[model samples]
Every structure is written in C-alpha cells, then in structure tokens.
Target: MRLRQLLLAITLVFTVAISPIQTDAILAEDMAIIVEVEGDPNKWKAYIEDYHPFVEVIHVYDTLLNALALKGKSKDLYDIDKEDFVRTIHPAQKYEVPNAAHSPSPIKPPKRNVNTPYTGKGVKVGVIDTGMDYSHPDLKRNYKGGYDVVDFDDQPMETLPTEGMPTLHGTHVSGIIAANGEMKGVAPNADLYAYRALGPGGVGSSVGIVAALEKAVEDGMDIINLSLGNSVNSPDWPTSIAVNKAIEMGVAVVIANGNAGPDNWTVASPATSVKALSVGASITEIKIPYLTIPLEDRKLPLQMLVGSPEWNFSKPYQLVNGGLGKEALPDVQGKIVIFKRGEIPFSEKVQVAEKAGAVGVIIYNNEEGVFQGGLTETTSIPVAAMTKEDGEWLLQKGKEKWAYTSYQLVKDKLAPFSSKGPVVANWDIKPEIIAPGVEIASTVPGGYQELQGTSMASPYVAGVLALIKEAHPDWGPNKLKAAVLSTAKPFKNETGSLYQPIEQGMGAIQTEKSINPEILIYESRLTFGKINEGVKEKKVDIVVENRSEETKKFRFDYPHHESGVVWDIPQTFYVKPKEKKHITVGLRVNSRKLEKGLHQGWLTLYNGNDEVYLPYLFVNETADYPKIDGVELTLSPFEQDKFKYSMYLPDGAEQLTIDLYEPESLRYVKTIVEDEEVKPGMHEGIINRGEFVENSYLVFVKIRNGKTYDSFVTEFQNFPLQP
Candidate 1:
C-alpha cells in the first residue's frame, strides 16, 4: 500500500507540471524575432538559452540597435519573453522595394549655377538598398568598399542571376548620386559606398535594414541615403529611431518618403524619423499632355496612367462617352473615348477602346478628386485619368465638343506617387523638400535607363547634399537640412491652392539658391502641432546662424493677418558675423474663430538680399493621424507552439487591451492584453497558444489615449494543441 501511494504521488506531480502546456497546442515551426535587452548581450544570450533551450541567437546588433536577432521554438520564445531581462520583441518584418522614368532635372545641375559644381569629391555617401552593379562604368569610379548584410560578406554587388532576381536599382540610384564616366550625377566626384541590405527581387527584412544602418554609421559615411522604406508610418518605429540616432552621430541621413502618395499620412519610415532628410518626388522641366476645349479656354489636366504610352496629340479629335469602358462602343472609332473608372481593369478599358478604333482613352474618376492609376499591360494608344467633376462637365459638354490636347509643361511639379506626411506622433512636415523623380534618366547596370520614383529623386538630393557638404564642410545635418528647406522654391498646386505643409514640404529644391546658403534656418518649418482649445498661445524658436562673414540684419515679412490667428513677430534683429541668435515666434490662436481644416502659410525672413521663407502650419482640434500603428505578429520558424506579438503606441496610452475572437463565428475568445498602461513606442511579448481556443482568431487592439479610444483589427488562424 505504501509503494502504490508513492507511485500515485509521482504521477500527480508529473501531470501538474505538464498540464499548463497542452500537447496539441498550435505552435510555430521556426520564426525570426528581435529582442531588445539592456544588460551584457553575451551574458543575456547565455542566460536566455539556459532557461529556454530552443532559443537561437542569429545575430547581435550592438551599434545602431542594441538588440539580438533570434530564432527559436514558438513555445520556448514565450518563456524567454517572460524573463525580466527581455524588453520589446519585434517581428522581423519583410520589406519590398518602393517601385520608380526622364525625370526632368529638378534643378539645373550645380555646374550651371557655379563655375565648379560640387561633385561629391571625397564625401562618402552610402546607398542601402539591393546590391549595385559596382562595375558599371558610370559608377565604378565613385564606388568604394561596402558591406553586404544579406550575404554577410564584403562584396556588395547586385545579386547574380544564379542566385535570384538581378537588381539595377542600387546602380541606378548610385549613378544618380555620383556617376562620373558616361552620365553626370548630382555629385559626380562624391565617393560612393554600397550597403547591400536588400537581396533578390528587391525584398528584405527589418533586421537587415537595421543592420545596414549600423554598418553605414560604423563605416563613418558622411551622408547615408536609404532609398528604401516600409509601410509603417510611426515616428518611433525601430528603424526610424535608428535613423534619428544616426543623425545625432553627425551623419546626414536621407530616406525616400515612400511611393504611396498623394494622400496625407502616407509617408513611411525611417523617413518619418524626426531629423532625417525625408525627400519627396517631383517632376523635372518636361511637358505632359492635357485636354482643352479649344475655344472655351477650359482645360482638363490628365494624369497619364503608368505603363501606358505617353499621350501625344498634334490636333483635336472627336469625343465620345464610353460608359465605364467595359463594353465596346459602336461609334467610338476615329475618336477619343472618355471612360468612367470602375469595374473593369484599366488595361481592359484601353483594349476595348482600341477595338473601337479610338485615337486615345481618357478615364474619369467616379469618385471625388484625381487618382493615379496604371495599366496592367502597355496600351497601343495613350490613356490618362481625370476628376469626377471633370467627367460630369465633359459629359455635359456632349460628344460633339472636340478635345484638343496640349502640354502642361512646368518644372518642379509634385509627383502623384510621392508620399506625404505629418508624422504620427511629431506631426512634422515630411519630404522636407522635393526633387525630380519622373522618368529620370540614370545608370542601370551596363548602360542607363529612365526610371521614376522617390527612389530616383532621393539620389538627386543625396548628390545635392554631397555638393553642399563640399562647399560647407563645417555644416551639420540640421544645417544641411535647413539650407535646403529655407531655399527650396515653394509653389501652389494645379488647383491654385497653396500646397499644405504636409503635401509639398516647402516645395522643390533650387540648386542655385540652396548650394551656397549664407544663413541656416534652425527648425526651418514652424509647426504648432495639434493645439487644444485650452492652449491659446504657442511659441517655437528659430535660431538664425550667420555663416557669411558679415553682420546681417534680419526682419520678418509679417503674414497677412487673419482674424483667428495673431502673430507675435519679433521686431528687427541683428546678428554679428559667426554668431547665433535665437528668435522666438509666437502665435495666439482662437480656436472658435479658426476654420475646421489645416491652417498653413509662409513667414518670410530677410537679411540683406538673402531671404528665407519658413512654412508654418497647425491643426486646430483633433489631428488626422493613426493612433495605433506598427502592429505585428510573428510565428516561430523552428516549432509551431508560440508566437511573438508587437505593437506601437504613438502616444502613451492610459489603457490598452487586445481582444481575440473567432474569425468566422464572431465568438469571443480571450483577452491577451488586459487594460494595462503602455508607454509610447514599441511594446512586444511572446504569447502562449494555450491561452487561446482552437479556431481562427480576429484580433482587435483597443487603446485609450486620455478619453479618446481607438481600436485596430487583424486576423490570424489559431491552432489547438493535440490531446
């Protein structure tokens, strides 16, 4: 009886120990994740591995991001996450290249403005993207040594066909910056360093990007140009923070704002990083097609569909309405067809128009405002898009009205695809300035190709900065940024409304005016963020540095007084040569009297013949921004049992909870994160599968920033443990 009782006790102990973990629990096979830790990395790795046997440390990043890239069994990762030494867990996010043509030269290359244009001589500019064709004649002279984080090698060349998709992006971008042989770059003499973080097919991961930044900073690059970015728009995203840190280290960081534009808040990081020189795409001095009512003096600008032949019309053509462009029209032959955008593919519409023997195709947006579109396949004839209002007016004018084509040739027009922003948390204007990106001709691999995107535009700015750096070697990143922002040529949109601080970002770069700046405008943009009704007065200071060797008098050209806003302009001030003066600008806003939308205008400061315009803007009440962003869930690659989840709180949240539900049945599952206080920035942890039921789950992240509550939803399949 004693022996049997002892055996029963042992059995019970074993059962209790294993009960918390279900055998049939849903688990990850093997997954990659990043863990932030504070103490000694080596000791922490050992401690983590000793406690969680399945965890594997892939790489340790000590420079830019003090974190570890780890792979492990899902269940074990959760156990490791529970330890106090561990901090935030990040999903190794996958990133793809932001997809780029003649971009007219945004600025006349510096040569025309000055006798000896600064070609980035001796300046090291790093290109962090897919590897480049370093051997390309245009780039070879400027190409220097670099690291390949993807392959963990010293050879930072474009991926070979034997490995994956060959890339010419890095080459094109490099050529745009410092190409010296066949075609001239912005800075033909600037030294180029390549960081091949992205691999085949122009796809990579967050860890890779972080690693690239680390390497670039370690290499002591004078200016780092990241022509790549992810869709996350948060200012505190890991890479964005890294960029901010990089700038603090005295290296100028320039990043592509993203290609998902003409909408506000579409800008992506690390362009969202506060100090980075975030660039936007603009057009060069080239004429694009538009439609006119010859005698009416009325014109409808057309945004040519990407992948369609350029619209070239020497004379007017007959017009007909082809409803939706879904069906072929009987009498559309020998005429221009106008189709409503909907239902059918744009290429299909063009094909239909072609079958009807139409001379050209024009697609009018069914919704309000203009839209950018593309054809799946190249069309034989030209096609373009217009606003819904234009469509209605065109249909009202009747088919008998001939559509005469003309060119809206202008320099520095904002590209429809270049992303815009007021960063989520900071509400700072992004793409601080624009450069030409449309149909920009630059070096590819063996030769050259005309590609377009903020990607192409980025190198232009990089080159410009290189030249400026050559001219002003003593300038820091902030000064360099200020030089460009204060001098860029601000312009109005096609609608005659001044581009908002978010949309145009102080306008396009003017090489001649910016290359030799005499004064640096600190915090070049005057932003009064989101003001509450209680906040009647706000003040931001701008430091004026007199770089020129003479004392200069500064005066403010007062903005047109509006009833709602009262300006506190400082009286005339003077700064001695080589001295810095801080001027405080204040605004008293009456919320009740202000309009409902974004209020923005320019304030001009003049010193002698030199002038600097500061763009100021603010939102009256609640700003239009995403409160919750950068939500990610990563499944383990080694085992199937557990997963790591991460989320970013733009502003510290008073209460936060993640509720899980059955995806198909709408059944409430469990709350993983209870109403807990979370601070600003990234928060991540591993979760045990046993906490959830066996069903596909829909996740809802509920957050409260003060009294305001917001929720974001996502879904994933759930796996149950085996009995």
Candidate 2:
C-alpha cells in the first residue's frame, strides 16, 4: 500500500508540473496589442505648445498646393508622429526658433541651392508605402498621378483622416526625393508617383507589396522606392523575384537596409534580393539653440517622491499616493517619483506621476536583464531611468538633496537599434549606402513627429537617385545602380560605432559626391543564370570594358574560395587602354545532392592603387561587376530510400556499388530503392536493383568508382514504409 501511494504521488506531481507548462506553451503563440488614447489632438496641443520651435511638426502631403495656400502658419493640424513634412516656407524665409527643450544637436542638412539641378526631371519615381497627403506644402508640387493598390479605391488619392492614418509616411519619403530649400533633396525636381500599400496599422502582406512593385514597373517608373521590408530568409519570396526582374529591365530599385540594430550585418527581404540597391540609416545631426520650456507657468515638476535614509534608525514614515490617482495627471507633486518598467504603459507612468505634482520621475527596469528605458513622445517631466541597482542608489541620493539636471539630447550618428548588415545568409554587398534615419523629424498622420527606421534611409537614396537620374537622363537602371555603388565611400564597420559600412552598405550616401565624382564609373549590370545540380564543374563568365578614354589597367577580383572557385588568369588584366575583354571564372562544387540557393560575391575591379601600385602600372582601373551565384538543385531519385548517403572510410573509396539486401528480425527494413549519378560532385549509383526487405535488412555494399575498397556490409532500417 505504501509503495502504491508513493507512486501515485509521483504521478500526480508529474502531471501537475507538465500541465501548466503545456498550457503556457499554447498561450505563448497568441500575440496581440491594445492601445488606449485618453485625449484628442486639441487637448495635446495645449501641452505641445510648451515645447519649442514647433520644429518637430512638418506636414508631408502629396501636393504642395494646400501648404502653399496656407503660406507660413504653425497650426497643430498635422500628424505628430510622421517625418519628411513638406516645407510650406523655406528655412531661409522663416525666422529661426530655439531648438526643443531636450534638443541633442543642430539639424544639419546636405547643402543645396534652390537653383541646383538634380537628375530626376522628366522621370517619374514610384513610391509604394502608406498613403500620401497630397496637400503637404513641400511635396505637393512634385506629386504626380499614382494609385492605391491596397483597397483599390477610385479616388485612391484622398486626404486620409489625421488621427486614424499616418498615410503621410509615403509623402515624407516623397519629399526626400524632391523637397527644395534649406533641405535639398537628391532630386528636387523629379516627378513623384505615390502608391499606398500599407494601411494605418503600418503593416502589409507580401502579396500587396509585390503587387505594388509589379504595377510600378508597368507604369514606367524610372526608380522604385521600397523603404519597408521584412527579414530575408529565401530568394523565393515574390517581392524578391520581382525586384530582380525589375533590375534586369534597367529599373533602379532602392530598398531599406532594415532597422534591426547593432549586430554585425543583417539584411531584410526585397533588399536582400541581390539586384536592389539596399540603403541603411544615418543621422543628419541638426543642432539648434534658444529652445526652452518654462518650468513655472504650467506645472513645475508635477511629479514628486519622498524618502529618508533614517528608515534604518526606526524613524516613523508615512507612504501616500496623492495627485490625480487614476486621472491623467502625475503623482507626488513637487517631489521625486519612482516607478517600475512593466505592468503599466510608459506614457501612463509619466502621466500618473505628473498628476501627483512630482517634479521628476525615475523608472527602473522590470525585466531581469535590462535596466534602462528610453523616453518616447509620451513621457513628460525630466524623466530618466536606470537599472534596479542604479535606481536604488538614486533613491538613496534623493534622500540627501534632489538633483535636477537638464539633459541635452542631441542626434547621434546612428541609432542603437538601426539594423547592421554585411548582408546575412550570404554576405552579398548590401546597404549599398546609408542615409539619415533615426529620430528623423518628419511629417506624420496628424502633423509632425520623430520616427526612425530603414524606412527613412530608403527615401534618402531614392531622393539621391532622383538627383542622379535627373543629371543623366539617358542612363538606365543598371548605370544608376553602378554609379551610386561606385561613388560610395569605402567604409568599415567598427566594433561599437554608429554606422557599420558593410551592413550599412557601401557607406552612407554622400548627397553631394553622388552628383559628381572622379575615376571610372560603375555602369554595368550583372545577371546570373541558373546553375544546374548535375554540373560538377561550372564556369562563370564576365566582361569588363573600359568606360574611359585612357588605357585603363584592370585588376580581376571576385569572392574567392580555393575549394570552390578558380579564376582563369593572373590577378591583374590590362584592357588595351580602352579595350574590352571577356574573363572566365571557374567554380567546382565538391558535394552531392546540394541544396538549391543563391550565393553572391563582389567582383571588384580597380586600376592603380593610391600611391601603392604606381610602379606596377599607371592604368586607370575599372570599377564594376558585383558577381552572383544562383544554384539550382535538381535531384531525381533513382530507386528510393537508398538514393544517397555520405560516410567516410579509412581505406578511402575504391569501388562503390550495392551488392544485395537481407532483412533482420521484425524490427524494420530499408530497401536499396533508387540511386543516380550526381554532377559537379560525382558518385556511383545502383538503380532498381530490386533490393527490398520487409523488416530490418543488411545489405552488401561495394565501391566500383576506385580501387580503395573491395566490399562491405551495411545495415538498413525501415519505419512503416508507405510506398
């Protein structure tokens, strides 16, 4: 009885332990988000007016007609979360105001004159993103005809509701291509065609995005701006293939490098599609002085806290929760407030303390691993946070004297979360360039707000492409991609730096230099053909021609792996000054049943090294050809289960061939069903040998390929063979 009772207890304990875990596992798969808005824009405006320059609010509309009509006015009728707002009045025309109270650095824009000629004149740039606000002051003049592929509405172009739609993300992006004035775009005069694929939720299915690209291509868009993307895993995604086809047709495709952050090199889909020019995010640091908020008139330090180190000395203390309680105000008026990170929303944390009359609030991390949290557009008061340990220290310090310090939040080079990349899965040269993307002040759903991501980086490139396209109207998409890639500054990613060149791409796109350059231009397009599975030895053929007048000494370079690749000639090849030559590169795959996938590598060609290779040859080298490898695996099963297997033998492979099959007991059986010869990596095969076993079987294996092994016995197993 005792033994049975003990066993029952063990079983009950096991059941109880596993049941909760199983339930939790099921619950984890479900994801959801709930947002609560307590007040309207009018209520927020009274509070917003307290912050300076009214600079963060810029409305990016599809057309500038409305903004121009409004002339110069600062109204709260704008999307507070959006960037890239159209400028109703030029920066020079308006009086400079003080920067934001917590301003980091002065906003620095690329230098451009009103009369500067940019490339994209007659060309049309198709923007596929959230809807565009056609009435935006800066973007209106450049707005052309476009379609909304999402809902397919007749007036696909309508003024989206400010509160419900941040349809302005596309408009802000459009401005980057053509916004004029103190903030000059790469192509200020380029025509714009906008498409709304993503809706208010800031999300879209793969089908919608790809459909938009196809439509853009059909509409004769010279350049397509894809500032949004998901993680890249395979080359089979529809958008990926479509983008590749677009490049082949001479259409310049620019996409975002993704904002996944600080890692070595990460790549997002569409951008990873090899053919697209991937752009990364950079910050255009802008600094402004004279912006300050009054600490008295409104509510000086609405939140507050009180603590005494004399607690250890048995001092009586009272804990109280004053202020608005559940109302939208802070807590502990005029005193410091301490809060935890989880449970409550950060905005609510600030609000709770604000109503309490607390002058400051410090939030400590709730997650075991993290200790710091950044302030968002919601948080008010001189808010700061620290780790649990740091928070405790600050609490102790507060008991002595409250310290109120103003922090100047300047724009940094790159946001910590900005995605890094050397282009993962395969390090194909990506992030072809970088552009401003973090906390970028632009137009939003209602008015202006600071937003960041690769979404911002892409438009920067698009705008630049517009400039280049306008400058050289005759250049095709291939020429355009090359020009941008070649002109990019060679940059390397440091351990803890803001920009990682390989991941951020060729380097941040220098708006000024892309319009002009020195040396051989990148003007060629690289197209890859299918690589069959059976091919044991494949040859890659490429051509490098001189696009210059003088004899250009060229150096041949492509991604190298001694085991897989072998080039035809010496490292350096000279094109009779202006001659063109076809070079052949060979690759040998030494494996069988290889999986089908895309592989990419850079085939860099340069002439004379800077002072390093003067004596070798003063040849003006050519810069072009980023090579690619596209492998197509085709394996046809000969018999079946015995199709293929790899095992290393000490004696080495001599003659490999299936002899016969024998079954063992009632365990299982595996038949020598099918076998076939695989190319590139060769192996002997025995097909339809009629070798079959019901249960478990032993098969005699022989190798006939070489003279290493005469014969051997191998066992095969089966698991309810269906066919």
Index of the highest-TM-score prediction: 1
Candidate 1 structure quality by residue, lDDT tens digits, 1-723 = 011111111112101222223322423335455567777767787776677667887667677766665666555666666677667433455566732211222222222122455666888899999877888876788888898877666899987668866666787788888888757888889899999988876777666788888889888899999888887888777688888998999999888888878778889878889999889988877677767775666778887765556688888898888898766688677798889999887878889889889989889988776776655444678888888998788877745978877886777578887898888766787878888888677776556665668888888888888988998898889888888887887767788766777777878888767778777778878888776674389899989888789899999999888988999988699999899889999999988887655677788888777666688878787665677777776444223355556666777588888888887888887888765678777776667756666556788889987778999887665555555
lDDT of 2: 0.47
TM-score of 1: 0.77
lDDT of 2 by residue, 563-624 (tens): 43333434776766556567665555432333343333344556666211000000011111
Candidate number of the best lDDT: 1
TM-score of each: 0.77, 0.53
Per-candidate RMSD, Å: 8.9, 20.7
Model 2, backbone clash pairs (residues 3+ apart or across chains), number: 97
